[model samples]
Target: MQQQMIDLEGPYRLLYCSSKGDKDGVIQEIEKGVSPNLADYDKRTALHLASCEGCTEVVDLLLEQGADVNSIDRWGRTPLSDARIFGHEEICKILEGRGGTDPVGLDSQSPCYEIDHTEVEMDGATLIGEGAYGEVYLVKWRGTEVAAKTIRSSIASNFRVKATFMKELALWQRLRHPNIVQFLGVLKHSERLIFLTEYLRNGSLYDILKKKGRFDPPTTVAYALDIARGMNYLHEHKPHAIIHRDLTPRNVLQDEAGHLKVTDFGLSKIAQEKGAYGYKMTGGTGSFRYMAPEVYRREAYGKSVDVFSFALIVHEMFQGGPSNKAEPPEEVADRRAYEDSRPSLSSFIYPEDFKT
Candidate 1:
């Protein structure tokens, strides 16, 4: 009996080779009579995968071999759209030159508040804030000042981080409450991920506390109500509850009207279930200082974690600042967990109702 030949000719092999940036493999497949425009189940062609992965040579080869430049995928995305979304500038230019069009448009049926990147003027923009993941800049859009949050290139390079950023943007766009910061739009770019939001002139709650030590009882009560309303809105979100894993003062901004608005949904989680235990969530997701005991222990927690953090914020309002400021944040969290240490509330500083 003759040995049977192992069959390997299929769209999957071609797609895999294209996705892995295997130029020689792609050439071999094309030579073996595989259509250059052959698409996978999702209608994603070799050109689409190559463009997404920034495989410049493979993209050129596919185009030269007669790959369709304007093929649309299952999600109404073209090869050019993937290139633009993934920040493959060269691939985008190449596709555009080949008459590729993003006719479906990034704004069409997308979660983001989309705007042309060129519309936002960054000339003479001021650096307003920064965190581990990105920087915030004070920029102008359509003659109005706005806060532009840009993810650092180093961090944005991670595919998972980009996905999370998009997911958070989707959640952010759906939120429309006075006590919550307004999301303006996302600046479409070929190389950067930039989000635009309303620029608050009064800065954050942390800055206020640092400048004035603490608010009076009446003011604190008002601010607390504002925060509570915002958090309540988040928890009561339709379809799913959004838990703000990080609810520190720094993430709360004060408006020119003296009203407080909850901002920064970077670490928020959408609870898939609204049961007694809520959704099983990841621990250590937020700032250690405001981290709930359950979260610090890497246990499954729920929306109550936000409540715990809210209580701490209330405590900070009465106490002027975080307790045990000299101690490291992790140590403070440890003390709170093991020793049940809490910031002392001053009888003179807070009203009777507040104390309760």
Candidate 2:
């Protein structure tokens, strides 16, 4: 296939190969004296295309072949900037390490720590959180505190669940954004998968809202912006966008700096044009009260569902209660959400133009 491409194209074989994610072909073409700095019609190099597609191997090959890492397309965006904006942290790291892009001012923080399981002190660990899939505990690792999620021992024998857990680990390991939880690492404790992460002493937004009532306008907007920015980064992510099919207040955690970082990827789906996964059960998935209509109806959904859920969250944040006065029956609730019914405004104090 690569040889066919190499023969089919004349001067721009390297760009074609990179665009096609043909790392070997790109290397061969470069070795054949094709300039690695060649650009396409829009002035985008193989590095730009590979970075946008999250073709890390191809990118590395290009850099090694003397490809200009700082090569910019018409938009003046660097490969490192594109990678960072699209949630490809490792790619950004590589670009930076190669002296292509400046990271001195960028918020690039990827933390990876290796510690023996025996070094983790679980004696003072306490139940911190829970979800349909697993349990979370606060434990001390290497004298620093962290949140540890334990894969249910009962499901240890479930092959599918185990596979999904490992998949989550793979995804989590690549994530490095200030608005997303930093995954420390994973450990095998008995029959459980213990996933460690940076612990936010400040609890979830759900806990704060329940205790303090409605948040002030500025505070609400601040938190909402943090979440929106995070979601935007995720949606524009390279290779595939991550749809947090479960974007509820409970999954949003606040840090000491008062910034919100999204947590949990169990129900996350890699957004694509088609073939997104969905369950066909009677009860809805991932907090129906905050679920998008498309998701509740078991229809094909993408990143927009998360935006819809965020709107619902903002509504609840203002209302200080559930979207529905009395949680409606499954059919009615589904119909209302699908029909674009807003929560009762008689009791909620919302800006008139909010729905607009």
List where candidate 1 sits over 4 angstroms from the true fold: 1-109, 276-284
For each candidate in the order shown, give its overall lDDT on alpha carbons: 0.79, 0.70
Model 1 C-alpha lDDT per residue in residues 5-28, reported as the tens digit of each score: 112235446776886689999988
What's the number of clashes in each of the models?
0, 0
- Whole-model lDDT, model 2: 0.70
TM-score of every candidate: 0.67, 0.66
Tens-place lDDT digits, model 2, residues 1-356 = 23323343665767657756898898788878888888753366888767766789999998888888888654345778557645677888899899877332242222322345786766568998896568889998777788988777766678987777677666665564457776767774544667787788898989978888876555666677778867776776656677777888888888876678888877776755333444332235687777677667776566778888888777777777566557654654576557876566652466666656
Number of the top TM-score candidate: 1
By TM-score, how accurate is candidate 1?
A: 0.67
